[model samples]
Target: MYCPFCSHIEDKVIDSRLSKEGDVIRRRRECFNCKQRFTTYERVGEIFPMVIKKDGRRERFNREKIFNGMKRACEKRPVSIDVLETVVGDIEKKIQEIGESEIPSHIIGKELMNQLQKLDHVAYVRFASVYKEFKDISEFMSEIKSLAPQSVVSYEQNPSKTIDGVPL
Candidate 1:
């Protein structure tokens, strides 16, 4: 494997193990030139279907896109990278299970939102705000309230308190 830090093509695998789901292999490699270590994942490739955009254009499915969106939503939250990876893996498994050649972007968006909603409320709201494109504060607050029925009342009482009740 090529070393990402120095671009050298020589590396030694320090560890190799199957992921929790046993579908992917995780490898920890140490670069021969830089002595730096990095992790990589090994999984079956070229099995994902094409993604159909809202404009009716078709493109190859990209897991990095999903990872980026998830990373942005999980920003400043307690969400971990491993959690995001597992979420992406789960989504990929779901899509592959559908056994279709083409899938709509909205379907992917809905699936992502559903997963995020269960993972972290703040991340879910962040992703929803962008994916759904709320027009005003009312719509945003409505979405938030739907996620947590008690949020509206609690927020009204203490506007500065965070979701965990830590005073801001």
Candidate 2:
């Protein structure tokens, strides 16, 4: 595997494991040239269906697009990178498992919101604000209040509290 940092072609697998319920292999690679470490995931390449946008336009599915959005919502929060990864993986897997040639963008957005809701309330609100396009502070505060108890529960229980740390 090529090292992502140095672009070195030669590398050794320092670790390997299954990810996203064993659908993919997550590998930790160490570059022989620069000794830099990176990760790679191997999965059965499937032809994902085109995502039909709300505007009635069709586009190819891109997991990175969702990941970037999730990252933004999760920014400056206790959310962990691994949690974002897992959420993205779950969304992708759900789409692929449906055995369809096309999927709606709304469904993808809902799935993202669902995953984010369970992961972090703050992140969920951040994402929802943008995804739902709140018009005023009331709308934003409603979302925040809706998330309060759950956020408190999560905060107290998991003080180390990283988004990528636990699926909950």
Candidate 3:
């Protein structure tokens, strides 16, 4: 291993641990030259399917993109980072289990939306807005309505009330 502090190639592993899922290994390393410590993660480089975009372009599957999108959707919400990480991990596992050389982007998007919907309604709508590309307020309302029929009915009855800080 290379030392991050001094770019030295020699390092000693101080500790090593497996992730909860047992799919990743974390190692703590100390540089021999600078005596600096850093952590590194190791995981099997499994082959993933290429994502087929809306425009018919194929690109390598990116885990970071999914995590970032979910992060943005859950921003300022009560959701925790651990929950988001688990969600991303679940999606990645599902994709791998599909065992396809190429998969439609919509499948991934729908799965993410489904996961977020169970996590937080506000986050689900936030993600759906972008993923589904709502053209107007009605389209957005339709999604919210589908999430909670009682809440939508109450909002219709009382327009002054707000759902997730948004006025009806």
Candidate 4:
């Protein structure tokens, strides 16, 4: 590696250590010319796929957006940031494994919904309301009922209340 101190092309690694997760390498190097010591970290660069929007627009994949969306969904809920981070990481890794240069935005949305549904029902509904853009009360109720089928049973028990005569 090139030495930053004297711009020398030669350097000796004094020590090397792996990061906690083993995804990074920390190296202590000494410049052969200037004898200066420096630390460097090496990591595998990730090439993320492009996000093809609903309107045909494309943009680089951003993990922060995923984290923010999950955070918003899980707000005031029992879910933790670490869980959200893992979900985001899993989605990112899955996309990367596909080896495609572009991925549909709807697919990403579906993945988020799938993970959130398993994580928390209330949070899933909160996210679905925004993601699916519920236009009417019936749509929201339908989603909530589908999310929790027990609600369907309870609503069935009350035959007086009818959702378009289907009894919810």
Candidate 5:
């Protein structure tokens, strides 16, 4: 393996371990020249379905995109990196189980929203606002109402109540 630090072509594996799920292998390597150590992960490459975009374009399935979207939504929230990683894994497994040559992008988005809704309400709304493209405050408020009907009802009953100091 090439060493990332010096771009050396030679490296020695110092240690190797399998992931708890047994789906990935982690390797600790040291550069032969600089002796710098780095870790690398290995996983079996599986064929994934092409994503049919909304614009009628087809693209290769990208795992990073999903992770980044979730990460951005969960930012400043109480969710952990491990939980997000597991959610991504679950989504990947679901896609693989579909076993189709092509899949619609909306399916992936809906699955992500479902997972986020169960994980964190704030994160779910954050993702939904962008994914669903709310055009006005009413649309945004409608989504919040659907997410927590009881809270919305209580706010409606109490006109004095405000969210972030703004009357709801």
Candidate 6:
């Protein structure tokens, strides 16, 4: 690494440490020529996969875009920022686990809808209204209705009940 003090190309690493989660390396280095010390962080290059849109356009995957869409859907809702961040992280992890360099936009939308549906009904309806392109009230109502439980045998039998139909 080049030294900031004397612009020397030679440097010795005085200390090295792994950051939280071990995704990056933190290194403290000393310039050989100026005796100045500096810290640097090294991380693996993130090769984001490409997203294929429904309109046949290809673009790089962006976390900001996903977060913005989620934020809009979550507006006027009780969802917390931490929850949103975790959802994003989980989505990214799933996409990476697939090991494919390209994925359809609709697939990502489906994943988002699944997450929003579990997070908040209002947010789920809001997100689905846009993602599913509801042409009328009937479609919207049907989407929401599917989320409601028709009958629960007994609250005691169903020890775990959740708003999104998931067993808590």
lDDT assessment of candidate 4? 0.76
> Residues 117-163, candidate 2, lDDT per residue (tens digit)?
87987788889999998999998888788777876576557656423
lDDT of 5 at 85: 74
| Regions of candidate 6 where Cα sits further than 4 Å from its true position | 1-46, 150-168
Q: Which stretches of candidate 4 lie over 4 Å from their true place?
A: 1-46, 149-168
Taking the tens digit of each residue's C-alpha lDDT, what string does model 1 give over 29-61? 889899999999876234556889999998766
Q: Per the 3 Å backbone cut-off, how many clashing residue pairs does candidate 5 have?
A: 0
TM-score of 3: 0.63
lDDT tens readout by residue for model 3, 24-124: 65768789899999999976334467889999998867766898999999999999987887788778767877777888888888779768877999999
Q: Higher-TM-score candidate among 2 and 5?
A: 5
Candidate 5 — what's its lDDT? 0.79
Looking at model 6, the pairs that clash are: none
- Reference-based lDDT, residue 25, model 2: 61
Tens-digit lDDT track of model 5 for 27-69? 6878999999999897623446788999989886777689889
Clashing pairs in 2: 79-163, 80-163, 80-164, 83-164
RMSD of each: 12.3, 10.1, 12.9, 14.8, 13.8, 12.6
Candidate with more favorable, higher lDDT: 1 or 2: 1
Question: What's the lDDT for all of these models?
Answer: 0.77, 0.75, 0.78, 0.76, 0.79, 0.73
| Residue 60, model 5, lDDT | 68
**Candidate 1 residue-wise lDDT at 118:** 70
Output the better candidate (2/5) by lDDT.
5
